[model samples]
Target: MVSKPALRTGGYIFKFFFRETKMNISISKKGISALLASVLLTLAAPVTTLANVKNPGLLVHAADDEATTLDPAQVEPGEGGETIILQVYDRLLDIDPYSPNLVPSLATEVPTIANGGISSNGLTYTFKLRQGVSFHDGTAFTADDVKFSWDRAMEMDLPEGNAGALSDVVASTEVVDDFTFKVTLSEPVADFLNSVVVAMVSSVVSQDAVEANGGVEAGSPNEFMAGNMVGTGPYKFLVWNRNENIQLEVNDNYWGENAKLNVRVEIGGDPDVRVLGLRAGEFDTVETDPSFVADLEGADGVTIYTGGLLLEPLHIGFNLNIPEGSLPDGDTIPEDFFHDPRIRQAFNHAFDYEAFLNGPLAGYGAFNPHYTPIGIFGHDESAPVYAKQNYAEAERLFKEAGVWDEGFSVSVITEEGNLFALMCLVLKDSIEKLNPKFRINVLAVAEAVFDDAHAQNPLEYAMWAKNADPAADPNFYMQAYQHPDGEWGEVHGFANGYKDAGKVAELIDAAAVELDTGKRAALYKELNEILYNDPMWLIGAQEGVVMAHRDWLKGFVQNPLWPRPSLKFALFDK
Candidate 1:
């Protein structure tokens, strides 16, 4: 039984296994001495630069997530501030770093109704700017800086801002001269130009560097544009240091292509210190983990792109209220413990989904349904997917929901060391190997303590895992993960966990104002067959979009609709 050689790299094949350790990274209550003291403080830090930054015009990367805010109307949505607002901001339509199509940076064309710049009752859009550009503090990029950067993100509606992708359906932002701009829209969205003007919170910035630094108020959070950045793109802002790194530099009044290289990013959250600083060339690029692709396979010059399927669907959720005495130390569960739809279809037929797509997605991924995320537009490759690991139909639906021999202990949470703590240790080893008095536990923590216990409202954990925020359509993933009042259904209560939750919020509010794109893909393929028979999230596995870098690091563009650490350093160079 000897067959394992597969490598490839630039054309993507990868099958390596020359292991002394190919993932035994057990994240059980964070041991391994805090991951070997974060890999010896990422091998004794100090690779920093910017007091005369150097080396063939700099290019670092190394990220695992930093950038809390360089404030492109307060970033947040897979925040590393969207790889620093896709390199110092400028989005009035952009996507297509490698293809979800819409291009026209700082708006020059893509509006449609066959380019009448939209307004055939699609509630007006009109852009046309991008003339002599200019805003890395040089000011002049107008239409009043796209109506003061979307009216200062809908008047700073910063509740952890992403300003509901422009306070959900704009409704006014005109300037119409000095290179014209318009907007209108109190409705008629139809994927508003691939989801909110190619969103990085619809960038644009610099209405004279935010009214000379500190202007737009209403809900607050400008604090000098949350750590300064002035915009117009092609790399500009150059200093962040918090948690160590984020610098950029090549914009020299950039209006078009000037950004040969000069970026840093580097806030390395140890994936073995970003593969030991990308095999010690001191990181040309890093943050690539499919359980650390055998520590960057044949590491000589490292390539590993492995791109493709990413509408980002990693699910697990389930919460349904859990607050009372917020379960933790020996989780006893039951604050309506996932409000039974046969105990949420017996934890979605006891999820093993091919051992989580060959363990923590090392076999890359697939399989998505609730809120339909495969490649967007109503993804129904014949819907129904439990990825077949039945275990006697999850022990006859946990003994017909009588909680199978009265057993149930909980705790799921995640985030500690990526892949949502290895898919919560594959759902605590597939439901405690199907009931040895079924207990499960995992917890993990640390992405800012699991985003402050996943923003509490009721999610004090009965289950929690992540992924899903990368969309070109699928009505903003059925209004923030299957609307029951949307946004994790008003923080996990899904109006007391769905069985009909008002007809899945009336077919996600009639597929978000459907302008008949085949009746909004038949009301999102009938809410993916009514949430695949009433399952309120367990959707797991939909990954694939790797990266790795440094075969002389030229023009990196792995797309997946570009956002989360999806590198776009002004189309790299070195």
Candidate 2:
């Protein structure tokens, strides 16, 4: 059975107030909203002072409520888990908020070819750990912990975990001393530091704590560490009330900048409820949808901050290897339907990209055809743009593929949500309109079922999103999508049976080890052209991240690499 924190009456009452008054609050008296009035009363109320004395902290309401796990190595990329993991774990190298370069975190400095810490051949890297640092459990951190953490991550071999980024790169780890270690790579990986070592998956864990809980042999979904945490970060885990909230307290012995406020992360999935909580002073900050910005604009004491385009781009992936008889509605799709480049190209041109972006996306997204965000390296601005709807060209390609005569019916699956489900509907409407014979079925499934379907078969089509780390090279995204035996292709079941899979894998391998930046960029550009012409997936819009916070919440910096803002330096002015 999972252990839960003692339910505080004050916390319960505060949550009740937000849940009850959220939708009904009106602005009538002197143009001051009931929510604003409630805020004023709550600030002045004596009960507020007593409540603060009991629990002096900041409450952050997340738009995403579910967290699969908190164990860094086991965590998939998500808003809730990533937000908490950032607070509980420290990486070897930290992403600088203001720049694209990497900075030191657990390590004293970043290793580079220019620095002697990295060998001349670029196959070996030596890291000097920061001395006097300790985990939240009060155990002193050492190089052994570093080696154990990374080795354990690779040994576990989680297909979905971010640690897969280092699968073939890290040959072995050697602990030199109490505060020093060296990582030997199988090949010269130019972006190994940014892509793998600096990734959150490489976060060091307490070897002793892990052993006591369950070592690598304990298997995945590391239940013990998922609910608990022991790391050398700025905050310590207090309690995780699953699907409800996660409470964290400041680590008094933190080696870096200490967190000013104990945090209470209330898990509310509805954006409107989160907005209401922010207005009623129930939360210090809240992650909100871009659609909610118009409603919250000009509200008192609330500032809407927009984090420009996220690293993730919304796209539609084709299941090239769907079994012939596996589709819904008893329809039998040809085995080679998605594998045919003509069909993929035709599907790409069938969507009305601009209409969907301006309408459902609230005019807050831009077209990116390379399956990569605009700001990242190797984006290939010269690649053929596919932003406009082209039904005539689509018809021609369909005819060439010999699927236009009878037309074909296929079910496209998307997770049940306002954005993704709406995207599926739009595609269905647009594709059906192109030809009456063209049948498109949009299936919106629950999050859990949808995740399983996506991982297992993906049926005929799947609409998904991917976030590539901006600080890392574009090879990270390419390896996942273009390479046949790569993480996403082989593990997550996407583009697994493409004819050029082997060739794409070879190109990706070549690009990974290329030391010259220009040569690497050219190789990626060539790969982008191949994928663009063949069209593995239909690239969609780059969505923006919009958030709202109270004016008193300070020092919140948005990093593209993370789904949520970095709260390490954040403080509650109140």
Candidate 3:
């Protein structure tokens, strides 16, 4: 089984110290004396001697752990790996940094119905790669590389990877020539190009590199390519010092103008530490939590970029199949309590949305009722809204479900984070206020333990968040909750015995392949209505993504589709 290299902070420091001093100890007495004299001369050297040396450029602080893998086909999508993958790989098409439209990158131009690149039926897409491009490893990039990269991603079918974005839409690919290829879809899909360009999984990789590195058939978490990279992007993979930092150098052989500065991405999980580091000038830019926004405002030489509503939303999920006493000792819930839709709907109405949204969220988040967030397509503005506090309705639903008299008690599990833990407490308070015997417990566990519990045996009720693709398409956002074969449903829904779970999955499948935009939107809207009524999840609010950077940093574009800013075109003035 493939596994990530363990964090070796102490080992790295020891090796660095030993390597730096090893040569010094080997010198003879006469050579040592000469070196000492040279050192004294350097100490006496003019200040201009050191001042003339060039700066290596920017130092960035990432608000995440070390990446699990760097291979485009195997890396998890979103903030976890996309931030680094964008710097090391180039895709056939890309979203415009300044706009939402698709733009040409490795491909010569954007394919559209009017551009003739897309067939009239929309089932066929043809692309011409930019000529004279070379990978970081010096292999010439061709149509074969594109085919091989996409085929590898689909064949591997890694659930955590971005392969899910295209696995449904793409049927197969045909290499027309060295510089051109065509993608044939099982059916016409309007968002096909957007899906390909916006997803890093579609980034081309060197075919020769894969074969040398055990090939795609070697299975997921490919050990060889995880630590190495062979892509045609502006930056090349240098080294990843686990738990410490990742270093990247500019690719001089790049087809386009390379980044003027090399990047050093340091791993840091504490938002406060990142803020202090940025203020101390140790970091040129950092991803910050919403709580840090107020402190960062008006600081000297600092600029904060706030995003619009995020596509991801935090919600409380129900494990309908949860068994009695499945939770930690001393916390026991009925086995089939959540199987009734009325209980789920009661919990939905019992939430104090206004207090939570305005209090913990600092009024920065908006109430979201549907599985799909507000800004994404297919979101119905006029959809029925859930009341912030409806004790009467909640009581009525509980009674109708035959649980109001006895007043059942259950616990809500969440990972340890200030915001998440606080949300769990707020939910518990709201639900318990309904009846005298009603009780709701809040359980906050360590992130690692929580992840294990969530994967192994999900609690009866839990609060969590989900991320969507850059396209903000409803087809991508809603699939996680509705698709029968989806990772989320398979793990959290089917395992817990959700009622008629396959109904929504059928709707999602139809919307995914539908060619007409209006029809597809209708299908999604209908699906959202069904979920809103059934109340599979107690949908919550969506917080805006906030980031902080030094004022001298320029050209950093914020894309709403992504959780973080894109630094591919970012530069340092000094």
Candidate 4:
């Protein structure tokens, strides 16, 4: 799927126009009718498409699901499924674009432990909440909201899927005053500042609102979250059609310079519906498939922004379990998991990494990435790199590892219809090529996949998200890929950490304690190298957020928080 660069701008910037789609398509019986109809239309009309509006404000699209609410306390960490989380909700701290460094979200500075270092005895930590911020409701924000949100998100029983990340961090909370509160950490922590980077709790959700909506429950998402967002952000919520579409109007009451979009956002739905609409020029901004980037060329006034997935790197996971370990409840890992490490190794080598990147994922910043959070400090280029289509070498590895038995059966799990599932299909093709006898089963639903993936013991699950605050610290992320007693996620035991958890723990701890950049960098270097050789996760192309907009759009660009539009900046061109 690799293509020679059609245009180059200096050595640093290579402009690749479009990557062609390469999915194997054997004409289907059902598609034949549509294919013939298209062919007949092509012959009948010298298609003359007309010009129209390129972008429009307060865009509406049709999507499948609607968020439950706009309450930050509810969808705070934000769902990967919700592309607009950032547009509606923002943190007090922010990610510096160029350096991607962590800094104040709600607070002006990182809270210092010395002001009261969380007592080494693992008892308590205290902080002063930043003042002057107001909630969307116009109520004055206070310390109680902080205590309430923290207690609600961490200690309480929140939604199972959305609230998994904050499990166990809070022990109790106390509001010292209108602007001061104390949080008791279950354990003394070095990266307590990392906690704030999580979409700030009180910064977006008020204490009273929580009680009215669902209180400490932080109940499932509702219209408040889906269509209406109320945070201390530069823009206020205008409307959201759940998954189908959404729009964000400016908040003149914002604390900073307001976002420029007359309204920012429109997303989700049929590609052809958007395509024909865009070609007619009825819309201003919308996504055009990278493969169709060629068609977009020469269309007057159309500009296809160029970028790639430089951060939020993607990866497929292997979930092989060993028999010796006990589940958290003391049940033993199933024996089938250890049937052979070579089988696990085969899947790793079989990935068709380059094909998808240069094809469907082209132009989205889908590049081969090393195992650090994209754009983070301490990324080591020398780490064992996984790149391109390596069918031959993957086969060699399979043979060398003895995975070529006559009948090898394994199930690959991924959420159906997602890019991750598509990646699994690519790997399946490559693996089958290596060992003609190998059999792969692809499962698309998350619930079904989770059932098998999170069972008492697992054989394997392809790249499902390993959720945690990677921006805050890699320690928790590193801790995630290990054999576990069912503590974190069911797949924990199969991740890279289980093989040598003790060593991984030691190195990660050492890296955390070293404050000096030079020392921290050195330790991190060692960590990436260790992780590379040990290979916890099968890293994939770091892909950027894929979004669609009408051609009239000018200012809309990918936001770091594009995971959801809640944080997106959009204002009309003057």
Candidate 5:
């Protein structure tokens, strides 16, 4: 259903508001949200006419599919990182969500080797840029478009490529003049400015929209950037249809301030058709699910908010090598009888996870033991708890780790929630009460077979599931879940393979080049004691930053990263 013409989207249909108004600073996604109450009554004017006007507010975000492209180097972050980082590309460095540090857009600051910032031999880094920052196809934003968007996803290799994160301490980028540039590093890379504000390595691209859209390739520029978008930030890209809706307007020559609001986006295939188009008003703000959080908990024109959700680690990934690890082309992994760590410590003490977080989240939810999620660094809200019925210490840790081969059993893939189908029926009734020769097999697959069995890394399931949130960086758990051939936390880090000694990938490179906040929190508390004693992964709860608006959707903030339902200091209460 590629759809999108069923206009009057929320119904009672006001028959066209008379189209044609998307020019001098485009408007009308709902007619610039009814001019957002006269730009919040001219918000005390004069920052150059609020930097050219276009804020007031109306944000809508909800994804079930269809944002696979919006040009952050031809988007495909597997699927929606909040519709390509808050309404398509802007990074000249971001991430300040109240103190994770590094701000400034299209750069004026943020780029220095502690001042002199050298590498004449320390490997190199120069930078200067940020002059008259242009490019919504107006060209001019140089240092050779930040050395062609930092080596354009490895000269067009992109699959959201960070050019293999600039292979072994970069070795190129020399512009050094028109606003300077250098970068050379083959060594000293400790947070080389958070590995160069990655949006596909320092996103700035526009070598004439990369040769009008295909000379600096990597795939998915959404057929030449959907509606011709180019960015210096503060909104500009106005239309997309590929799965059902996307709109961003308000670049009013933006250098800053003029960001009141006018960013609409959707991927709605169905979540009851996005809460019936946000309860029939169409949508002014969105981020629904968790079984529509008990149908909007309080209702009456919705508002619901919830924490900031530290980035995403909703968790479950197993492929240590087949019966959980040691794959050979995948699926049907139940052998050597799960090579016994007493059957992965009897399915990790047969997950009761506090009676599945006190049955259906009435208790709301809690239990994460760090595979890294709750605001990063091995979060361990006191680790040990998973006994809905600990089958006598999971049959004494499955006959003391002999992997109780009572005809061997292991198969747990899930995805339809009562919090993961009640932990896949509490690991199939506590791993069949730890013996009946222990047999457990629960399947569930829906939502494109849970996204095509985790993008086809399936080996007949011994373990598989989804959840995420840790990419604000600390090599986001070694470049997405222990870089096991990582391409950005592919449904639970490292679909297992890419140098597996995973000693938290060398303490995620000493907490990503050690900027030293108590030695990067003591090298992330020694990589959370080798990620909770190498459980490889299993963080279950601690994600609350939810949102559901309508009480006139007042001044929003939300962003814990990704289009977390963009509000960026949102407003519209009048």
Candidate 6:
């Protein structure tokens, strides 16, 4: 059996400690005796240092990943970039770190139809901006800045950026007054506030700062903004030592509750190193794994923090149209490899779901249906799913697909030395056991290379492994993963593979604009059933979050809805 490593549950382990020593030595005839006496005293007990060297409230965090860019519009959602963005920038609206409820941030209140903040038709939204708020640059926050920031993000719709969150619904953003902002959507979108407004991509940036730096350009990332940050949150950007650590200091000038502790986020990619640091009191917290729970649960001064299962679940995406000349084994596999529904179903049944849930996930996960996981709006516990592997079903499907005797070879890609690669190895082991003719190659590549290839039109690989970005609403999931014209759908050519692509697209579009909660949910539930029959991706288990932190670190709330390392530093105190 191929050994699989634990999931790199990206985390921010804040290790806080400071030591300083001061010694007074007499330069008399007894200099050697005095120095020896002072050294003995220091060894016996603690020595007091100067007031200037006294330790302030500070935390040093280590993580498995680093921020690719600080630009809110450019950063990939749910990545390391978000942890920094939420600390440094404030959105018009915010989600409570402990709950899914929306909270007022830059805006005076969350816009709703009941308060006339949202239009009856739901296309228009008006926000009453907070007064006396200022960006890190000391510029007044106003409706004009709000409009400029939103407009700039929409205009600079870089292909790699998360601008689609805004560009997809917003038709225009208008400033009614210095403190009033209005947004008109092209269509009435259900859960628009939770999914898009509260998202990091919709975060308001300093208009003056951005204009002075690299101005907004369509389809191009602002290099200046990517490296620097200026916002109206509880923390200010102190310094970002690339590939080393990022430091943030408490913003004394913040309009809201001030942050209790200054944060220093270090980039530590190796989980073993992070674990060692946590055990040695070198890290207050670390990006923890389920496997590490056994190691750290009994360690002194450590607390294991576990929260609800994350909405994000890893999936094995099947590409219907593998590009010509890109197949790993062209002689054995065809370009239209996963175009057959039976083949997709066969692969789905071939995976050992229970093993994965208990193995790498440590039984803290659930087998969710495609595109819907626990805590997501559309997720239903009653939904049918592939709960376990059935070799009989796998063999029967292969025979039905007429590939029992002529088994094919194909390569599936994943990031090297990660849980996704391990999942691929699991799939490889199970599928190969069916027949000697069946062959599978797990192609592990660097993350950058994998991402670059994953982003290609009509994905080059026959299959690839990765997780979905967490979303509060079903519309975002349907559009990105289920809709025929959506990101993965268009790229993987699900329109060609799906039996009724037009019908699926229709239902997804209807769900997005559906105002009635019952109707919207019903639409998604229907899609879930339809998709289960015509599977486009293999649903991996959804893992809950578990972090190990120093017992002294209080008020650590892990909200799966927030970005990875799920704690909000402002709410924490040591």
TM-score of every model?
Answer: 0.37, 0.85, 0.83, 0.71, 0.33, 0.88
The candidate with the higher TM-score, 5 or 6, is: 6
The Cα RMSD in angstroms, rounded to one decimal, for candidate 3 relative to the true structure is 9.7
lDDT of 5 at 48: 28
In model 5, the worst 10-residue window by lDDT is: 9-18
By lDDT rank, best first, the candidates go 6, 1, 2, 3, 5, 4
Q: Residue 209 error for model 4, in Å?
A: 3.1
Candidate 1 vs candidate 4, lDDT winner: 1
Candidate 5, residue 307: Cα displacement in angstroms equals: 26
Model 1, 1-574: lDDT tens per residue? Answer: 1123444332233343222223322232254445455445544655533341224678988777566787877777777778787788888788777666778888778878786988778889898888888888776787887787878887888887788787778878888788988888888878888888888778888887778777888888888888988888988887887776878898878877788988877774656656756655566887775766766766665678887777778888887867688788887666886787777887888878776776556778778778777766677788777775677877897898777887878888876756767677767777888888889888776676887888788677788888877877888888887788988888887778687799888878777777778888877878888887778788768887777876677777767777766668778877
What would the per-residue lDDT of candidate 3 be over residues 405-491, giving only the tens digit for each residue?
A: 877667777766555665666677787776867887777777676666666644444334323334456666566665656756665
lDDT of 5 at 47: 33
Q: How close to the true structure is residue 296 of candidate 3, measured as C-alpha lDDT? A: 68
Candidate 5's displacement at residue 128, Å, is 5.0
lDDT of each: 0.75, 0.70, 0.68, 0.50, 0.54, 0.79
The regions of model 6 sitting more than 4 angstroms off are: 1-56
The alpha-carbon deviation from the true structure for residue 22 of candidate 5, after best TM-score superposition, in angstroms, is 40
The sequence of per-residue lDDT tens digits that candidate 5 reaches over residues 241-326 is 65566777666776665666666667654444455445433465565534455555655455677654546554565654442454
Query: Which candidate should be chosen as best, given lDDT against the real structure?
Result: 6
Q: Point out the higher-scoring one by lDDT: 1 or 3.
A: 1
The 10-residue segment with the lowest total lDDT in model 4:
7-16
